[model samples]
Target: MESKTVLYIILASIVALGIVVFQYIYKQKAKSKIYLLLAFLRFIGIFGLLLLLINPQFAQKTYTLEKPNLVILADNSTSVAENGKELNNIISKIKATKELSNRFKITDYKFGSDLNILDSLTFKGKNTNIHNSLSALKDVYAREQMVTLILSDGNQTIGEDYSYFKAERNNTIYSMVLGDTTKYKDISVGPIQTNKYAFLKNKFPLETYVSYQGNTPVSVFVSVKMNGKIVHRENLKLNSDVNFKAISIQVDANSVGIKNLEVKVSPLAEERNIKNNRRSTSIEVIDEKTKIALVSDILHPDLGALKKAIESNEQREVSIFKSSASKNVLEDVDLFIFYQPTAKFKQSFDFAKSKNANTFIITGSQTDYTFINNSNIGIEIENGYPQQEIFGLLNNAFTKYDTASFDLTDFPPLISDAGPILITSPFETLLGTQIKGLNVQQPLLSVIDENSSKRALLLGENLWKWRVQTYRNTNEFINFDEFIGNLIRYLTSSKNKSRLNVDYEKVYQGSSNAVITATYFDEAFLFDQNAKIRIQVTNKEAQKSQTSPMVLKNGYFEADLTNLVAGEYEFIVSVEKESKTAKGTFVISEFDMENQFVSSDNLKMEKLAVNSGGKVFYPSQIEDLINDLSTNKAYVPTEKGTENIVSLIDFKKLLAIIIIAFTAEWFIRKYNGLI
Candidate 1:
């Protein structure tokens, strides 16, 4: 079929018909029908030339079906701010341009705290989540051949990994990075937990953390201050790999209430940011010490020695229960010690009546060897006692000794003729290494009843002899009191009662939506219910949940970080147990990577041009682009090309000319020409 350009060509045909009529009228005296026909043929040629002027071409079928797809994408996270660049606000600025809107059939999307089509935009959301926004893009344009435009700060806080977004691209993705990238160091102090109030005068553990870039510097001093006065300060050296530094401080709090604790570290010379060098935490001080119960056999030197030893150095409540005499005592002591009970095992259970107290059983100077031989304490004495003393094992989980002086294997096996005592079965051996216990010839102190829940400390020789023999070295053993203090500190220290630590010292703006990650190592860290985490602002009292159904991921258990507010929030994250919860304090700060945003020197719209399959030209060369697009799309319409037949018939100028020629023809023939 022939193609026509413009309704003008059709109007030309009407003019040609009028020419045929005019020729017939002027040559009325000579009957020239062939001349009129030739004139009509010439008019057709003129109309054909006019079609050529419009420059029509056949629309090529590139594929079986022409499917046009449109993709809409936007930044959904809070970190998209362009730092000082102010480029994020340009999204609104660009919308005001009339030229861009008129150029294409557009679909718009916006993201801030959540994914949404950008019918409206407000500056009130918390932060942006990029992963969810991308997923929304996939869902909305799933079936279309799409070109996606992403507006973000490149700070992605969601997704298993971020490389997936960058590596694989099934569709054309145009990234319009909204922020500039730069570096800034910030330190912040989180909330302090004052609930399980700890106050033991001049020193208590004040937990806080330090955040710095990797390998930034070393040799910084950290100080703890209370109420505008400095209390404790320690010099510290740092490594780059140590992004976090959690230090337990010795603080002095006189009484209970809201008290400010300032954990300050000396600023590094190269530390570009110094505002976060000092962190402030709050605490409620209460005068309380750990409670201890000691069950001794009779009045001995060890009591006075222990009392003075514990009193001068340690902080604890000590109650002496001479089990051979009294049965009545105070309830709910923290630790229970049974010292060579002359009475019997009945007193062991009686002293442990307070369910909360931890039990510690010691070998006595006159341990009922006859009864112990028949009982199951994991060790049994020989019928004829060995002339020499021996020591065998030296592992904390297994044995409690610095070094083995005398091997217990030379004495006798822990198993008696009755049964096994301090050891496991006759078949099994418990050792992480091959240095076996000397049980082959004669086993020493072994864990007989493996069900021994209470940790036992066994000594082969009566260590009281060492206490008496200490006068030899006046300088070395000058202070016999110090040795006993170390023993008591290890025995009574509530190291097990410490909290799982979460610290927030420094965070960048880009890392705002990131989860507050912490480091923890439980001898056995496992899952439990009734676990809740409370995060409050560093200065303000606002709390949110950090609880997740699952506490572990990739071997490390984690608490969820969703629905958290922005700013430096102090967090009292805790794991609840049967008695008291293990708690740790940390700070969480909103990171806006756009805070580093800078104005780019290169403003070329390469991404915008490529995604749209258009070529980018300098501002001076934009005319070529506009002209080319207009030239390519100009006269092309419906049938994917020029509609020749419709154009030929509907030309208005040609219709008016035809009507005038018909009217003149009718007037000449009816009134003058034919008559």
Candidate 2:
């Protein structure tokens, strides 16, 4: 196709012609028509071979008239069909407009918690997530001219806000607002906020957000009911409509185990929506005391701060001692926190190591790396250099526990020896060191999970600086105290001694989805998904039992127990192959989320329509909506062209032609008495 290829083909043809002339005209005695035919066949075969060598290709063009995509995203959640009559009217209107498919490509989808292509709507979805629906549509029809029609009540129960979506300039979104938008007298109790665990004899706080929708001032009575009895009560004066008040209540933890606390605001006489006036949450009250012994080389402020932080939790008791005195205390405590252990503390360290106690070591200038390396700890500090100040940066992938409070953006740096921190065994690093504003690939805080013992390492000292700096910034020690407490809790907690581990909460709200996850480990302590984990659940109140198998996903087994009725429940998780069993109890407290709101969010739907250059319409205005969409200039169909490049050598017919030409020439040569 190019000039260079043409020139090469011409040169090849000339060479073939000279060869044919030499073979037939000069060498052959007979110069008749047969000889000429033979020379011509030879030249033809040579030129055909040269052409095949060129490997020419051509473009195959295709033309098409692509219609604009009309995406109808229908909300199939329960909120959309709260009133069956209104939902039916909307569906009937959508079906009546099916004739629009004649000019546009119609694509129907249904969205609740997940987005899916719709065969039909059943309106059985439990949660509504409008954001996921539109985002999924945007990803699927990214390059197509699309006009989306969203029909919903616009009550999103989960995921991010849908108003933040940036729709394409050419694309349009028309929303059909559903349900009643008129204001209704209502009182609702929002989510409960409280600590997950409480100590016996200590009082824990419960905070709830109470909202009201009424014009007149009302005296709302907030009460905490435990075990079906009122434990605490208070009254608040709500002055205006659309106002929210935060109420805090404290309850004494008189006994251990899981305690279900119900917080409710007594509804007004005229309030019609009373289903959301109450909320329930549970907390575990434990009596076990985790005794920790702090072993230090010398008396320092860092040591004292660490002791205070660990002891802040009522369940934890920290005893500080010099390295010489630590050996005597190591036998009495469950965990050892060694601060800057030097040669003098070698005997105490060996005693703790021999006892197989959970240990957390903090390294500093006085830390003897040689002595630490000789120990069976999972990490070894190599090429030790001068001490340096390094800030802490959270490792995002750490899955040991909730790391949301590990944010250290404004926190000061800690002092540690500068060098590569080497990890020798299987471990997880929670924090990495950052030097001079650049993240370095060195673990600042890490956990080592060994079969025999659980160990943790903090590759720095001067932890007192964090407490001081945090207090200076926020006028509180919440960050540093929580961080240190969480670290100690993680280090001191018992290791996964069992091959099968079930992770779940003690209780869950009835209206919310309940999920329990389990991990199965083989004899080698490796995650084994094929171990076959199954759970036997029993309603403790009714004595009804059922068994279900957990599905394996991403090296973990997950069981969804969301549809269970409100009652006290117990579950026994068993691994079929391992013959290991774990039992746990949880209560599903009654709470109806569907009845929280009685009206649709028409404002959200209006904003979605306006932002996408479209109009919002009610179910009765469907015909007008259809007319507007059909007349829009940008929504019309457009011609599209597609081109494909195909190589000539790839065609089987061309190969057959080449074979036939070579065969026929050979036959003609043989018949003409030419070899």
The lDDT, on a scale of 0 to 1, for candidate 2 is 0.81
Candidate 1 has its poorest 10 consecutive residues by lDDT at 426-435
Q: Where is the poorest 10-residue window by lDDT in model 2?
A: 648-657
lDDT scores for all predictions? 0.47, 0.81
Give model 1's TM-score versus the native structure: 0.45
What is the Cα root-mean-square deviation between model 1 and the actual structure? Answer: 18.1
TM-score result, candidate 2 = 0.67
lDDT of 2 by residue, 222-323 (tens): 988877788988887876753788877788999998888888899889776777888888888888889888888677789878877887887888888788
If scored against the real structure, what TM-score would every candidate get?
0.45, 0.67
Candidate 1: list runs displaced more than 4 Å. Answer: 1-108, 112-145, 152-291, 299-320, 324-330, 344-348, 353-358, 369-452, 455-461, 465-675
Q: Per-residue alpha-carbon lDDT of model 1 for 150-217, expressed as tens digits? A: 55555543343322443123445544544433454434333332223455464456676666554455
